[model samples]
Target chain A: MKREDLQLLQKREWCKGCGICVAFCPTKVLIIDTDDKVTIANEDACIKCRQCEQRCPDYAIFLEEASDV
Target chain B: MRSSQLVEKYFRTKNLPHIWCPGCSLGIATRSLVVAIDELGLDKNKTVIVSGIGCSSRAVGYLDFNTIHTTHGRALAFATGVKLANPELHVIVISGDGDASAIGGNHLIHAARRNIDLTLLIFNNNIYGMTGGQFSPTTPHAALGTTAPFGVVEQPFDLVKLAEGAGATYVARGTAFHVNPLVKYYKNAIEHKGFSMVETICICPTYYGRQNKSGTAVQMMHWLKDSFVLNTAYDKMPEEKRQGKHVYGEFVKKDLPEYVEEYVGIIERLKGEEDA
Candidate 1:
């Protein structure tokens, strides 16, 4: 799936700011925000590979097929 | 398609925000198993999750399925009874490095030797995380643990090698960083009809990390990515260079008759002979 066609969902409370997702994300789409939680720093660059989802030990982040709001 | 949906569909919602320490890779490994089970379209009622004592053993309580939370180091024994009684259940045993390789070492080998139809997932964090960071059978030599203040002197178990040597029909190794491949191995292990095991290298920041002076959770994850070589590439590395490195991949997959099947065959033959 294309990055533009995906929505990144972050459960901020569950994130411990472990950057395994960032290390695996080929697109550099994620960053540990000031709060020590994962954030989509580059939404447009996301490749929708779901590496973040797969690597998240917290079950804190995921990708969903974008739904019309 | 939604994160909440994944959680609600596959997990027992009330039991989560699981008590696992933040950055513990047990959650990551558990999710891979969940994904494998979901993708396989297995019947939840017929699937059983069995676990023995340890941090990883707590997974049975969280996963939404028929689960057996057995005593320390005896999960395989309990699971064996469960599988033999029903023979139709998909039994999966989740155990810690200490629980599976130390106290339960005998059961682990015998189950594999018998070629039982079960998926034995070893959540190997090297140290005994739940028990105040004691050194486990899989702890790397010289790694610090609460019990090994002077640095561990004994050799560690090569878990995949042990499983293979014990006659497991399918054996694989995966680290927490390699999530997708880990999930694939979980799926294949579950599908295999004989004794199958996947040793998942996990990060225990609260124990192994602190004792070893390993960096933060993120850094530990990077270490996991670095410390293991794929089985294919490991073959070419010289013997000296291969020391302290793990080889991750499926070591074996064979079409072998499972324990339950052989037992049932004997039962059927006995019945026929009695009639004659």
Candidate 2:
């Protein structure tokens, strides 16, 4: 399976509008939205680093391998 | 010769095409460590590598040494046990900032405090690179991360000083751009008698570089070259000019009884008591 098949999503309500994910992302995949929520702006660029998943204080983000779905 | 060449020599086939990103520094750090081991002429059978969860932890799987890819942030603790059980074995711990400092902070301190005969190489990329770009404990204040949208508000930890304060006999810091020095530091740490640590400030091109707009791997290398000052190089510069940049090379080295040696002493004393 292609590695990019992994998917990352943010729970907008749980997001504190913190841009920690944006700053830590090596691929610039996530971006801060107008509503102060984090969104996947460049999903294709993600290397599934999972830095955001572990560092998020609110646990607002989740990652799932595409094969699992 | 480039250290990466040595890594290719012993790399496992099953794990071909490592999981790290193209410009990720973990691979470079891993290569440097492996090459250092080979250069030191260390017996693979006598060497044991332990690692905690993270992108850097995957090094255990790629190497041919006795390896344990343990749970997140517990590599040092396991390495401590391994060394105490078999003092003849050379133990090495490969970890990332989140795995080494954040979750494994306590183990790190105690291992250094006890002066275990183990080498710890921390891949400090500032941000957590594996779980998406998130602010790690090492992330600088006002830095952007997944959790810190505006900026990281918390102060980052100085891993080298922490290890020194925790009683490590040797400590140093290097970046991927300085591969030769990094390999040298790793070799020194491995040869040291007591707990030795090298904090490698690597680049998380996929996470950290992208967020910081550091361009690409080449750009990150340029930044690293510009940010770090070798001790010898720094000594030539004005003190004021050294501010805010990492001082590379050996920071601390001293003689101290390693944990296994002290433990062996205890065992001997107990035997004497039993005889009495």
Candidate 3:
């Protein structure tokens, strides 16, 4: 997702596409693509709840605080 | 070379690409422990990780803390000594079902009975992963393992009940799919003053999964999502409806005088009497 707003730092290599983050997201911000990799579907709809960051099994998702530049 | 900032800080990045097979839930379990420690803001210098010989015990090498990789079934003994020698240290034990319940079961019970100040995180994968998929003490009845090709006939030990019966001040259970809840349990366990035990229902995708046909790692994760029921929710359901459901929740939490604290008190009092 875009860093100007609420950004998510993802180390995709660690990701096993467990789909826990995609399902746990409130705003439906992520999706497991056809290749079984997570993709940001709606960046602006993201609420930065940190649910995904907390629940991901592989520690693939990292939520960065929104920086006002 | 570390890509993740959190990993760089807490884990040995040089040990990147851990030995655990892909889709193994151990990483998630270890992550919860790290997250709990971070949330608690525990001083790394004063923290110690004691582990036994098993796949779950591999966490000691990657964790950036005072760690002891002890022999089979001896992690609890080593951790007890480490805690008694330095009461200031936060001793954490991470072990598998076989290492903790099968071989080290006595140490576990006595430690909890003593109400020692230590957090024991038992990774209950059901089967012994590193030991060629033998049925462990926590393995579900009739579950398939290498040693039990026709399925296990013996019943599994309920860890939460055992810990509570043995006098642990804090006891909780959580699954790998419920990482947030696992982190909360771990955080609470770490903060607990007396002996604390958190049984993590982890997924062993390599040996157990392949042998039992439990599905791929992702599917196993989804199975956990579908199966786990919190104790609160279970209480709300009808008794018959709760059958076959694995309940995960904080079963007990009480403030008890920790063994370490009490032992130190006795030492000071005896020393004073001798001086007098």
Candidate 4:
């Protein structure tokens, strides 16, 4: 499946703004905004590597319920 | 499966987001653990999680399992009793560096010597995080801590070697940066019978980082990536090139008589004698 096909979700309140996800994102798809929360800066560029999801220390960013496809 | 699904299934949702600092690697290590449990398809109802006092020990409070938040450095003692009472249940102990080595040091060695059927995961962040970043037994030599302002002069304990010397049936080390291998090690450690220990190297960016000028949280993560090498590669690297590099991998795996089974066997034998 394409990277953009996966629904990405982020819990802003849970984010502590560590930027681990932002730093580990291979495609530069995330950024810590002014509020110090992770936000999708370039969703279309995402490669679906899931590094951001895996590396996120706070569980702030993740893909929607993965299907068995 | 997706992380959200794992969280929904394995975690106490209301207790999150955890209180760990923004750059702390405890969450990552914790996630890998849940993933291992999920992949193994272990029965949540039949599993028990135990922990002692420390930053890493707080993990028990978040996990959705039969859990015990025990006294500092005594998690192994409580877990031993729990396992002996019900050997059918899977017992996993989570401990911090100071909790496992300094205060609970004797318990750790004795537990390993007994070869009890329990899994111990030590979150070795090299500092006493909960107590404000004091130097821990596993803290690297010459590293600075609140307790070691001028850097530590004493040699740090090599946890893998310690466990091996104590007679652990299964021993391995993994770091927060290498999630996949860590998950694999956790899986193996949990599945192995007799005393099993996994020393998970993690980053305590808030305390360990700030005190040592280790740069930002992101930079610390990179340092973990660059400095740590798998045991296999570490062996082949030149001695000079290996300086300052950390090694992690399965150090040992061997089966021995598990304590509970032996104790039970003795009981059964005595009962047979009485009947005769």
Candidate 5:
């Protein structure tokens, strides 16, 4: 059975690479790539609280819920 | 912390021990607002406190009045709607600098221009405290933030001036250190007939103060007490003496047709036509 929480990923092109989401996430689920685009490196640890989604300056990342998986 | 006090009565027992760090001025500002509300003897049932997302936005959660903690930077817009729907309701918007003047700047100006009957308590701690110490519109030039480690190149918005220019009927400024004056100004704003604003300068010791080497909360409070000159007293001081200091006091106050009242008039006129 898939875990109830889903791993989230980002669309690199959409990310201006602002690190606001990275700073805001209490769970530390997001990381900035070398190109300044944010990447969801650890999806399993994500609480899916949408802090990144709400704070992302570029709207680059989208959370895929566990139910979708 | 009198139980009979309006501010004390609305204290959230469940959220006891607030998350704000030591020396944060938001708690002081919140208490001043509540005290002002209580002193005015405003009907609790007709009071609505609205807020946008930020560390200070947590004020809505703690207040016992009708509260709506809306999306980031949208508290003014939401407060405008609440006041319009029920003209008798006393609506107040409480938010941080970023929430009020950065992303939510348009709403702030428009609300003032419309002369909406609402009180806006802008907690200007300079940096964006909630999402880390990021530079906000109110961040002083050369101040360090997570985004501007090298130093901020941009000039900060003077919110009281902006509100006064936008046509707010009553405009004033106060700091966390001056609690009694702050509360008194807040009460005046609440009683004012049109859009009234009180820009409360708060300390963010965890972020802005620490990064800027401004010392602890007490030190910041001392700085605020030292920095401001009351307008009533300032007018009597020499112009050269006032150059580097910020003057705080009521800046502008004049009655104008409120947005909701005009809107109601339009609705009534339209309804009359329909009946005719």
Candidate 6:
């Protein structure tokens, strides 16, 4: 993903590629991109379980309200 | 509340990226703590967080509160002093397994015995991650560690049992994988009037996982999920089914007179007598 697309997701810089969020995502909605950081490969596949939000060590990825857009 | 919101509210944003290794459970465990504090609507000014040296102790630096990073294994001792000196402050001691049970073991039992109004949260990763993987007191029997290259022969200390035996008013156990219940345990522990200890079983992915072949951080979390059952459900399981499995829940909760209250009463009584 390019810099601007990456900036759209909140706290994306904090992700350390621990893989906890990507590994635990039930829908396989996330993937570690070539940059070794998490990028949403399939946003539509996200179930919004928030398990990733709960277990992320870096607080890097979380669900933002659609209204914030 | 949103994790981002909790981060903005409770953490020192300047230290946004923590020093902890990637995939460490300390972040998850630490998140539960802030969540508990937020859920309770505790006054940030009145809450004091004290910690001893370890990965868990590093949390104090990132949190936005009155925090103390004390000497090794002296977290509870320092917390006791904080509670006694202020009496109005809500003192919370954050310690690792080695910091709490190994080095500061004496202080732990004594604080529990005194029944002080301090909350001790033990982030038990089973091994000493900060020192490059030495065997800690909570390392499970036969677990691999640098010191126990041949495997640990001695039985590990059950922190819940130790706290309960030492007369703590509240004692509970939770794991990082079980974040929701862990937050509840933390909340209840803080609200308890007397000394309370909540042990959160965390993961040391770099050291413990690699040494024990426990797989990646995600796999270790799954291990926690599969190995530990809730206390209520654990009791109903058959003996064969319970083997190798640990239980997590509030093992003990009872009312007890707090140490500060008793000490204050003594001072008040003596002052009244002198006036007469």
DockQ values of all predictions:
0.52, 0.02, 0.33, 0.51, 0.01, 0.45
Model 1 agreement with the true structure over B1-276: per-residue lDDT tens digits: 224556667788677678888789999999999999989989999999999999999998888999999999999999999999999999999999999999999999999999999899999999898888999999888889888999899999988889889999999999988888898999999999999999999999888898899988878988888878999999999999888787888899988788999999999999999999
Q: Please give, for residues A9-65, the per-residue lDDT of candidate 5 as tens digits.
A: 554554555465676576887787887667777766788775565333233455554
Say what the RMSD of model 5 is: 15.1
- Collision pairs in model 5: none
Query: Which structure is stronger by TM-score: 1 or 3?
Result: 1
Give the per-residue Cα lDDT of candidate 6 at B149.
99
Off by over 4 Å in 5: A1-69, B1-7, B271-276
Looking at candidate 6, what is the lDDT of residue B131? Answer: 91
* Candidate 6 CAPRI level: acceptable
What TM-score against the true fold does each predicted structure earn? 0.94, 0.76, 0.89, 0.95, 0.76, 0.94
In model 6, what is the error at residue B67, expressed in angstroms?
A: 0.6
**Cα lDDT of model 4 by residue, B119-194, tens digit:** 9999999999998989999888899988899998889999999999999999999999889999999999999989
Clashing residue pairs in candidate 4 (N, C-alpha, C atoms within 3 angstroms): none
Task: Report the lDDT of model 1 for residue B20.
Answer: 87
Question: Relative to the unseen true structure, what is the C-alpha lDDT of residue B40 in candidate 3, on a scale of 0 to 100?
Answer: 94
Deviation of model 3 at B192, angstroms: 1.2
CA-lDDT, candidates in order:
0.89, 0.81, 0.86, 0.91, 0.80, 0.91
Fraction of the native A-B contacts that model 2 recovers: 0.00
lDDT of 3 at B267: 99
* Candidate 4 segments exceeding 4 Å error: A1-5, A66-69, B1-3
Candidate 2: tens digits of C-alpha lDDT, residues A1-69: 354665776555555554656766789898879987778889888888766654443335657653343
Docking class of 4: medium
The segments of candidate 1 whose C-alpha lies over 4 angstroms from its true place after superposition are A1-4, A66-69, B238-244
Residue B88 accuracy (lDDT) in model 1? 94
| lDDT of each residue in B139-180, candidate 3, tens digit only | 888999888999999999999999999999999999987888
Locate the minimum summed-lDDT window of 10 residues in model 1 chain A: A60-69
Error of 4 at B15 (Å): 1.0
Q: List the residue pairs that clash in candidate 1.
A: none
Model 2 CAPRI rating: incorrect
TM-score of 3: 0.89
Residue-level lDDT tens digits of model 6 in B138-254? 998899999999999889999999999999999999999998999999999999999999999999999899999999888998899899999999999999999989899999999
Number of clashing residue pairs in every model? 0, 33, 0, 0, 0, 0
